[model samples]
Target: MTRTAQVVVIGGGQAGLAAGYHLRRQGVDFVILDAQTTPGGAWQHTWDSLRLFSPAAYSSLPGRLMPPQTGETYPDAQHVVEYLADYEKRYELPLQRGIRVEAIHRDGPLLRVQTDSGAWHARAVISATGNWSRPFLPAVPGRSVFTGRQLHTVDYRCPADFAGQHVIVVGGGNSAAQIATDLTLDDHVNVTWVTQRPPHFLPDDIDGRALFDVATARRRALDAGRDDTGGVASLGDIVALPPVRKARDAGLLQASPMFDRMDRDGVVWADGTRAEADAVIWCTGFRPALSHLAPLQLRGTRGHIATEGTRAIGEPRLHLLGYGDWTGPASATLIGVGRPARDAARQITALFADN
Candidate 1:
């Protein structure tokens, strides 16, 4: 017999935890099915040195306060995992670990999600599996001929692994910057950064105000549709305190121009300049791995689901959290999942009433 849940959440990270929390609060029967062996989705795979850019105060789950931090820069990956574990315990969330969901399609009136373990039937399903599942890497002309080790930033574990090697870190996001900095400080590896957009680096704190205030402004710009054209980078225009400004000006670290082409020996820049590297780390980010949920009529470009605010296009019952640009504040971070979860709870309550 196929077991059924009132609601089924597809991923068990902070987003899934948030959904589970609200479902429990609303007295709804739901189950969270995660592919991994435990909670804290991508955090489990993060390098040991990784730390949340957002402070502990901003990184707490809904209804549960994170343990106080000693300093300011935020806790490491392990801390995040511990906090998530604590949240699940508090809410008594129905989480089934190591249950990899393969496909989800609509069945008559309910959505059916099939997994390696079993099948789950639900009126609605929320995909909290973040964008990190599919790492984006561009085909740099002649990649096959590159006579060097090439790996995405997601595959990287520690700086000690690349010790004494000439490395090229691609992309300009915080991940790339942090990895490059780590390698520079620890491994003494030669590093060259390649990026399409220059990142707007900010201090963890500014005049005692949280860094999220600046992040909120950027989110507003994105929500307003001013960022539609892929125009000039807005990150540079945002004002920051002296430390961040000094870092950018000093070129201690900054973004490089976009990539152009590549050959077996080295990578070529957009300006026709070539740089040699023994290894290349592409920090190009990721995409939604929704191959598992092919049956839902998802409105999206490429493989990503398109959502209007907290609503998942026509699938109102299916809310997406930890997805960039879906909701207010910082929807992509663990701290941002709560607001969407609350909205989802309201939507689910309305759905139950309609049924």
Candidate 2:
């Protein structure tokens, strides 16, 4: 079935929900299309022990403040999922779940969004699909030849699964640090943490709240034509959460240099040093989930759709949100998405006004 709307939002995750909230506030007729069977989006698939870097209230959407999670400073994955579901319901946003957008093609003046359930032709399309679906695994040599179990951060659930195993955790990001620390808690499990470069830990006091403020300040400085070398990225990659700090204090978070290649039973470094491992967890990160927009042929040499702010430079009717700082300062986070979402909604509304 082919449906019609003024706007169709792809991806009903935090970013999509934020865009929907602002579109609703702008009094525009729009509907959100989500690939998830449920409302939580990627949060539903995150590790069980994963927690936000900021407190519940500090990390919220545009309209509602996330309710405080009892007995916790930073909310866990399940808490975030609940909040997302509640946020969607609270706003009464028009949403259709379990609809995977396949491709978006230009249909005369409208953008035709083809999905598994049906198609939506809209005046504007907001592609808010976040990157969780495409977990990045670095192409280290002999990865396929290794006999050991290999998994990305997305596949990791709990330490119980790796009990009595020597596990190698790779990456310099927060996910690697937290997962490495969690593995150390299991006495039967041995964890060998490695990173391509030395791990950069953010200040203990710096959390999501501080990160958001820093990003906002950076954006403002840039907007005023000032060179501000300060943002969440400048601080550090790893957030020194409780789990990470505890592991650091206990000397359990020591990281070795990344291995050059893997053999059948173990990994080898350039200097000929080697370590045996039963499993390897790659927490490399992710690419943007923008494959559905391939038909538009917007990706540049860098595998990204160039945009002037959130609006596509190639297609005026297309807007990309929640991918990263390129769209807007910290737009990928729950707290930061509001700025770009609100901006996109207003821009699309003004475009309609002009029409």
The residue-by-residue lDDT of candidate 1 on 21-107, one tens digit each, is 888889888899988897677887887767675567767878987786566455788888888888888788889999888888778
What is each predicted model's overall lDDT from 0 to 1? 0.74, 0.93
List runs of model 1 lying over 4 Å from the truth: 197-199, 203-251, 270-272, 300-304, 327-329
TM-score, candidate 1, is: 0.87
Highest lDDT against the true fold, candidate: 2
lDDT of 2 by residue, 166-260 (tens): 99999989999999999987798999999999999999989999998889899888889999867777999989988889889888889999899
Clashing pairs in 1: none
The lDDT, on a scale of 0 to 1, for candidate 1 is: 0.74
TM per model? 0.87, 0.98
